[model samples]
Target: MRSQFLIGSRAPSIEMLTWICGKPVFALQRGTIYIVALFSTICPHCPKTIADLGQLHEKYGDTGVVAFGVAAMERAATADEAGARVDTWLNKELPNPTISIAFEHTGEMNKLWWVASGSYGVPTIFIVDRDNSIAYIGYPDTEDPALLERVLTKVMDGSWDNSAEAKKAHEKWLQGALVRRANVALSIKDFKTALSTIEELNEAIPDNPQFREAHIKVLLEMMHDFEAGWIVLAGLARDAIEKNDGDWLLAAMQQLFGSPYDYSCLPSAERFSMGKVLSERILTLCPQQDGISRAISYGAVARYFYESGEINRAVDSIEHALELVEGESLPDGEKQNYLAPLVQALAEYKGSEIPREFAEDPQNRS
Candidate 1:
C-alpha cells in the first residue's frame, strides 16, 4: 500500500537545475546523511524552515550530514529568472546560510521528491540515512521542537534504520498523500474525486483539523452542494456545542468566514446563522482570554456580528485585533501583515471609509 519511494526505500539521487551554494551534490554518498528541504521563494513559511535547515547544517555538518535546500514552486519568467529570484531572496533573507542551496527550475525535484514521496504542501523534508534510505519524510516543523534532531540522531546511530520510528514516519507521510490527492482533485474541479478522497481520509485520519475544515470548504464553497455540506457541518456544530468545545467551534467557523471558504453559493442567512452560533460559543468557552491568540477568533466573531446586523460589534472586534497587532514589538511592516485582514474586515463592517489610522498611507501613521 505504500509508494515505492518511501521510508526505508532508497532515496532518489539529488538533482538540481542550479546550485546556489556549497559543494554541489549530485549523488548520495553511502556514508553521508542528508536533509533535503523542498521550499518556495514566495512561501511565507519557507524562510523559517530554511533557517532551521541551516541551523541543522551548522550543527551536523561535521557528522557527515549533508543539508541542502532546493527552491521549488517559484513563478518567474523562466528557470534562469526563478533561479535569480531565489538567489536574491537567499542573500536578503538568509545571507551566508550554512547549508547547500539549489534552485529547482525543471520541476524534476518536485515530481521526484515532493509529489513522488506523497508529502503535502511547501517546506517538505526528506531525511536520508547513511544507508541512503529515506528515514523520515514530512513537515520540517511540528509541536516537537527537537523532532529533527532526535530523528537525525537516531538515523546517525543506525538505531532508526528498519525501526518502528521509520514505520510511523512512513505511515504519516502516506496519509499526507491522501490530502495531496484531494488537493490535486480539487485543482482540476474534480469535486467527486475530491469528496471521495476526503471521505476516505476522514475515516483513516479523523483528527486532522485542516482536512476537516477543507472538507467543509469543498462541499459548501466549491461544489455548492449545500445539502451535503450542511448534513455533516450541522451535525458537527451540534456536537461542538454539546461538548462545549472551543477548538471544535473554531474549526467550524472557518466554514463561514475562513479565507479559503468563500461561501458564495450558500445563502447569506445560513452562513451568518452558523457563524453567530460558532463564534458565540468560542467566546463563551474562553471569555477571559483577551490576548493576541484570542484576537484571531475576533475575525469570525466580527463576521457573525456583521451578518447578524450588529455593525458596531463587528467593527469593534476588528479594531481590537488591529490594536493588539500594533502593540506587538514587531516592525511596522510585520504589523501591517497581521493588520491587513482585520483592516479589510473593519472596512466591510463599517460600510464606510476605513478609519484613517489603519489605512495604508504612511502619513497616517502616528
Candidate 2:
C-alpha cells in the first residue's frame, strides 16, 4: 500500500505541554479535525500562517475544527526556545486556540505520521478529521481567507474530495478575481495595487498553484515599482515553501524571472540564494511537466540566471527549453510569449548563433 501519510490515515496524537491564555494547556485533546501546521518559529512563512490560522480559528472554532501549530525546534534550548518564539509572536497577533509550542516530539510525530522528519518549514497546514484521520494534506495559503475557508470546509465536512463542484466554484472565484483584478490594476499602471491583488490571490489560494504563476506573469508584464513588490513576493514565496507547496514556489520563481527588476541591482546575496533554493525545489517537483507551466518555469530559470549575471547558465537554460518546446507548432500566442525571453537571452549570450528574428536586435530590447 502506498504510505497512508496523506488524507484518510489515522493521525498520531500529540500529548504535550503548551501555554495559552497565560495558563498551562496540558494534554490538550486534538479536535475532530486537527490542523498540525509543521513549521519553525524562524521559518519566513510560519508567522503569516500563524496569523491567518488565528483568523481561521475564530471562524471555525465552533465547527469542531482545531488548529494546532507544531514547530520543530533544532536548537539546544529546544521547546522552551521555540515556545518563547511562538509566545512573543502570538501575543502580538489575535489570540486563537492555544498554539502548542513543542520541542521534544518533533521527530516522534513525524515518524508516527510518516511525514518527512525535520526541516519544518513555515506555512505547512494539516487538517486531520475528528477520527484522527489525515483528511487534507498540503501547504495551503493561510493569508488568503477564501482558500483557507475552502480547505477548512472540506475537512469539516468529513469528505476529502477536492473535486466537488463547490471547490471548483471556489477556485474559479479566486482565479477569476485574481486575473481580473490584475488586469484592471495593469491598465491603470497602479503597480502597488496590482502587486497587492496578486499577493492577496497568492495568500488566498496558494494551492490553486497556477494562480501565483498568472500573478507573476501579469506583474512582470505591467508593474514598475518592482523593488517593494519583490520584497513582498519574497515573503509570499517563503510562505509557500513552509507549506511544502511546490507549485506556488515554482510560480514565484517564474515571476522573479519575468520581473523587469534586476536582481543583480540588489546589494544583498539573499535574492540569489532564494532563487537557487526555489530552482532546486522546482526541478525536484516538476519533472516532465508540460504546457505553459513548463515554459514558464524554464523561462524563469533563464531569467533567474540572467538577472544574477550568469550569462552562460541563462543561455543554456533557454536553449534547452527551446529544444523541448515545439513552439512553431503552437498556434496560441502563449507559447511564443514565453519563448521570446529565452530567445533574447540566448542572443545576448550566444549572439548570431540564434536565428535573426529570435536574436536580440534593436526591437528586442524591452
Candidate 3:
C-alpha cells in the first residue's frame, strides 16, 4: 500500500472543535518546529506517549518547538460521550497534563493528518519542520528514548528530512501501515483481502510472530479452513516449544478455546489432542512460582477439560489457577482484574452466583 503523505510534504492543518487544555491552537506557527501527537483516550498506551511528548515539549518549547495533542473520539458512541471521556482522562487520569490537548468531534483532524499520513492507530507522532514540511511520521515509541532524542535534535536542526535513519523509519512505517490495513480488512470481514495482505506481510517480515498469529486467525476464524489453520498452528506450536516461548503457546491455546472463533467446528478428538499438548507444554515451560503465567496456563487447561467432559478435572484445574492468583504479588486493583475472571469461571463450574466483590462487569472495569 502506498503512503498517503510523504516526508517533505506540507504538514496538514490542525482543525478541531475546541481546545481541552491550554490556549486554542488554530494552526502551525510560522518558522517553528511542531510535534503533533494523535491519540485516543481509550488507547492503553496513550498516557505514556502523551507523557513522553510532554517531556519533549518541556525540553524544546523554549527553543522554537511546540507540542500539541489531538485526542480522537474513536470508540465513543456520541459527541457528548467523547467529551466526557476526554474530560475524565485529563482530569482524573492525567491531572497535570503537560501538553496542549484538543478534542476532535467529527474526526476532521484525523482525516486531515492521520489518514493523510497512513497512520491507522493512536499514539502516532508527526513532526513539522520550520518550513511547515513533514519531517517525520510514525509511532513515537518505535525508537529508543535516546535515539528519539537524537532524531528530534536533527529535526530541530533541519537535517532529519534527508537522513539515513529517516529513510529506514519510513520503510518501517510502511510495514506497520500494511499490517493496519490487513486488520481493517479483517474487521470488515474481507477475508480474501486480509489474507492477501497478511501473506505479503509474512514475506516482508517472516520473523514477526504477529503476522503468523494474524494468518492463523484469518484461516481458522474467518475462512473456517480448519485443515490449513491446524497446519499453521502446529508449526507455531512447535516453534514456541523450541524457543521456550510460553507466551506464544498461551496465545495459541486461547485461539483454540476462546471466542470470535467456533472451535466446535473442529473434531472433538483433534481439538482436545491439540489442547492437551499445548497446555502440557505451556505448564512445563511456565514455572510454578510464576503465578500469573501458571494461572493463565491452568485456565487454558481448565477450558480444555471442561469442553472434553471432564468436569472434575476442569474444576481442579480452575481451582489451581485461583490458588496461584492468591499468591501473586500484584497490586490490589490489578489482582482483582485477574481474580475476577477466575472467580467468574469457578462460579460457572460450580453452578453458583458470581460473588459481589468479583462481580464487577468486564465492560465497566475499563
Question: Worst 10-residue stretch by lDDT in candidate 2?
Answer: 113-122
Per-model TM against the reference: 0.53, 0.42, 0.55
- Which residue pairs show backbone clashes in model 1? none
Please list all clashing residue pairs in model 2, or write none if there are none. 32-129, 32-130, 122-242, 144-203, 144-204
lDDT, each prediction: 0.76, 0.59, 0.78
Model 3: residues >4 Å from true position, as ranges? 1-117, 120-175, 207-210, 351-353, 356-360
| Tens digits of per-residue lDDT for model 2, 1-366 | 212234455655565434334222244355655566766555676666766676776677787756666654433356666566666655655354344444433455544432431112345566666666655555554355476567668667755455574355445444554556667777887777776777777676666656565555554445534565456567656865666565667667755555555545443467678787887776665565765556556666777787778878877777777776654467545455556666776776665465665555434444
| Backbone collision tally, model 1 | 0
lDDT (tens digit, per residue) of candidate 3 on 35-121: 888888778888888888889889988999888788865545677777777889888667888989888878787788887677877
Task: Report the lDDT of model 3 for residue 338.
Answer: 81
Error of 3 at 277 (Å): 2.0
Which structure is stronger by lDDT: 1 or 2?
A: 1
Error of 3 at 10 (Å): 17
Q: Per-residue lDDT of 9-96 in model 1, one digit per residue for the tens?
A: 8887665557878888888889899998889887888888888888888888998998888886675668779878998998888887
